[model samples]
Target: MKKIILGIILLFNFSLVAQNPILDIHTADFANIENAYYKDIDNFYNQFVGTWIYTDSVKIIRFKFVKKEMFYRQSIKSCYVDYLVGEMQYVENGVEKINSLINLNINHSEIYNYNLYSYGKTNKDWYPKCLECPDTIERLPMSYNEPTNDDAGLEAAFVMHRADENGVEKIKIQYIETIGAYGIKPDGSPSITTNFTIPYGDYILIKEN
Candidate 1:
């Protein structure tokens, strides 16, 4: 009877562990520091280091500056001067869940150029999804051609679309990207933009702890 009870307890513990498997977030290995451009673009990169909440949806995004590293593939080497990591989370059915993760690589010379990578869990395993993907969104200084009534100095525009069996529609999310210098107005005033800018409407986000 004692042996049977011990076996049952061990089996129950194993079952519990199997049901809730641990996920490894740090599975990505970093290459040697090829080039560091954080010093050059520190001002631009610093603006993204914070927790941003989306008011339209239950989504929250946080960005933090990471180390500069070089990635190589197919004998091609590209240096990421200012590396920023972002995590996205949302609530579903009253349960908060991580939707996806992203790593951004910014060029030192072209502050607007950004290389993005999607990192998250796939089939219960963490993997880096897009590496040097062609689809990229850039932050450009507000051009005189694209005028806005709002007093914004910069703007980031990306053209995207959603496709279904019905067809597709051209969509562009152009809005006030950043405000002030280093996220503050020139006159020492505080101005912030919405987290997610969509064609349908602009949504506001609150900072999360």
Candidate 2:
């Protein structure tokens, strides 16, 4: 009997394609590999899974992330990718804002329609806050997009840890929303910058004990 092994190695130096964990793509350099199965090999996406809450006098929000794996991607090339699907409960200034916690299931094939989508973690040498006091820390990168608003898409850059010195898991996110530049708008104009109802800003969220 003869064994037949095949590999589909595609060299894409110009454009990124078939990257695992496509939400944030764990790899620093795009690999020309076979089968578009962007698996979370390092398990970086696991830390973001669970319920996180941030509260203050005027703002309160509870966010949850669920892992969606082996999801087929059709935006560019057809491939299975991994992503952290997010849902949230938001309120500001004593007024109820957005609450989609009731719809926190991870059965949706389309990741872009969710409140947040993230995959993998990365550490920056320039912004290494804790050089001496702790374990490995990495940032969770995600994007926020409200399904109804086409113009509202923001990049969520979050720095997270499983626990602190006091053993409290925390995550810090930037207050300002970084708009994603996919391309120009449908009318051939620039992409519009927009904010969300969720006071998604500079916040330190603590995981539920």
Candidate 3:
């Protein structure tokens, strides 16, 4: 009728500019993916400042990280994703609230030696898989354990420095408790303490040599 009503108003302005996530930059969808996901989470906490340790049977905590910040996504369309949150102001209740809940999601692969490792999708319920496990969105030599007998359990106990089988410098000690079977010891061997009532969740990933 009049060029079909100007081609239906230019297809409704291209579907409202492809559902506006900051005018859709080729498809990050939402004002430049929350500033490219917090500039890769401030370069992954400035390469995780330094020091981190977590163990259990009662306690052992050391996380002395200093810099981390990102929390800007008030309603850029509200699909609920806009954070790079950090700044634990040093420990208070252990591992600075589990390393600010180790929530990362930006790993645009490039054979990284840590080139902004992990790109998108690591928000594993934000604490409470015993506080983020399977080391959610993993990369750097990740590890996890849980199994103190609902099917078998033991949760954790590590001291790896492997080489054995002939290269020998070995010093292994893995006893991940309670998600299933787990046991391995050789750090001066002879250990046996198994008991699990179930309610486990473990996480590990270390490679900062």
Candidate 4:
């Protein structure tokens, strides 16, 4: 009886401390993964971290980004992931309309705790699809949620690109919006209109630091 009890304890401890297979996010299959840690082993998330700004005569916007590591994600199964979380500040016509960047440095317990968050490395293929983006280059995809978009009835996918623009480093974000088949209504009907306040188009941002 004593020996049986000892063996059980040993097995349990091993399971708890056992290292899960670590995978690079670029080529990972996000589903059906069990006890695996999706890692940014190459530090791909670093380049996008920090402050990026976009400005025109009328509109000025800034996006602040940071990498949050080893977040527990619940899907069909439980897995650990590394990803980017972001906050935005928007101004148009000299009036500040939105700003959520104040809490960017404070790590939230959940990704959805923020307005924008996503995981995945440079992706070769994505949905709502990238039209002008070349297949040869991979882009980082992120999903955005506005606090007032409780029933916005639209999908906003923003993909990031890094390149040299006129001898300066710039990040290009393509904001692609898509309409879904479902709605917030209990009757299972889509919303008749959208409540999107953000502008739609490509934004060119410069690194602030």
Candidate 5:
């Protein structure tokens, strides 16, 4: 009896995709600073500052006075948050949210305060705040064979999250009327009746507790 053993070696030649060396260097720089911030307690002084705005039909406004907080060089990309006291304000009208406070479709003053936390670097301006911004609103742009502003189309979209001290991560909900309910949260606001009901242009960033 002859015993013959056949050994096959399977080699996977990984094609090394040559990426730009400068890209790695840039990433490393940000990453190194981020790591240091996480480890140091004193580094938790910066606030995760962002903007919030709202609109009805007549007026479009921005939190023009939103303050910019100091961010540690090491905290550029880390998931760290430092609690700093802050407040937010807005104007409302005869809407359900603010009708009791005042009447008429005129803008009124409103404010909310919260502790600061850090998220990753966000775009300086998510949606430019322009009162004259066109009504180019759509969850997804209509293409060749897609529905565009039919009766059955996506309505209001909202991003919700709790801006806590440790870090902002409790909930993030986008309300599309086409999907479900059409009322504001318990905290007195307009019942997001329809997609169009949401003021165009101004992005609403709800900072949770």
Candidate 6:
């Protein structure tokens, strides 16, 4: 009777451990993954801290980089955002006024991942389908149009590319804007629209002190 009671107790303890083995393993795995993810974010932020400039014959854009506090996973983290405070200066009707603008430092890979996971399609196939279409459709360049209420339509996009010319680290910035007029139809849709992108200027910006 004593041997049987001891055997039953040992078997019960072994079963308890076997039943929840995954819980013990995942606790350690999650800790290591979280540490690596934050480390990568910190390294990426350190690479993008500086001031950049772009100019044209008549206009100029000075982009200043600054770190801002953001809430992530119930904790505060530092991230970079373009703060236009005291950086943008333009003349309007012979009066100079400061512009306030803030933009996120979005990565191209993030955009690609978003489209891939959300739509389950590559960038080439991510588009509206027509009623009558061929079996195989050639991919076209990606374009987006934003809705507006003003008479003069507006479209804007930003492109960033890296450059290493003569050992000087630089980034090429293309900020394109299109302005036009559109006629509305009876169904509250754009009937006839004419648009063209005015050439502002593209610049290769270097890190400034």
Best by TM-score: 4
Per-residue lDDT value at 105 in model 1: 33
The C-alpha stretches of model 1 lying farther than 4 A from their native spots are: 1-42, 56-75, 78-80, 97-201
User: lDDT value for candidate 5?
Assistant: 0.27
TM-score of each: 0.30, 0.66, 0.21, 0.78, 0.23, 0.36
TM-score of 5: 0.23
Which digits, one per residue and each the tens of the lDDT, describe model 2 over residues 7-78? 222344223453433432577332233336676777778877889899988888888888887776665456
Indicate whether candidate 5 or candidate 6 has the larger TM-score: 6
- For candidate 6, the 10 contiguous residues with the lowest summed lDDT are 113-122
1-209: candidate 1 lDDT, tens digit per residue = 99999999999988765653332222322222232111322233333344455433443432222333322211132333323333344444446443332423333443222222212112211111122223443221111111111323433322111111233221221233333324443355654533332222333343343
- Candidates ranked, most accurate by lDDT first: 4, 2, 6, 1, 3, 5
**Who is ahead in TM-score, 2 or 3?**
2
Model 3, residue 98: distance off in Å is 19
lDDT at residue 175 of model 3 (Cα atoms): 25
TM-score-better candidate, 3 vs 5: 5
Worst lDDT run of 10 residues, candidate 3, spans 109-118
Question: Residues 1-209, candidate 4, lDDT per residue (tens digit)?
Answer: 99999999999877765756677766778645787888888887787888899999899989988988888877767788888889888889989888888877677777787877765755546754557667776678887866556554566778886755787868888886776424564355555536456697888899986
Best by lDDT: 4
lDDT score of model 3? 0.31
Give the whole-model CA lDDT for all candidates, comma-separated.
0.32, 0.61, 0.31, 0.76, 0.27, 0.36
TM-score of 3: 0.21
* Candidate 6 residue-wise lDDT at 144: 23
Tell me the TM-score of model 2. 0.66
Q: How many Å off is the CA of 112 in candidate 6?
A: 21
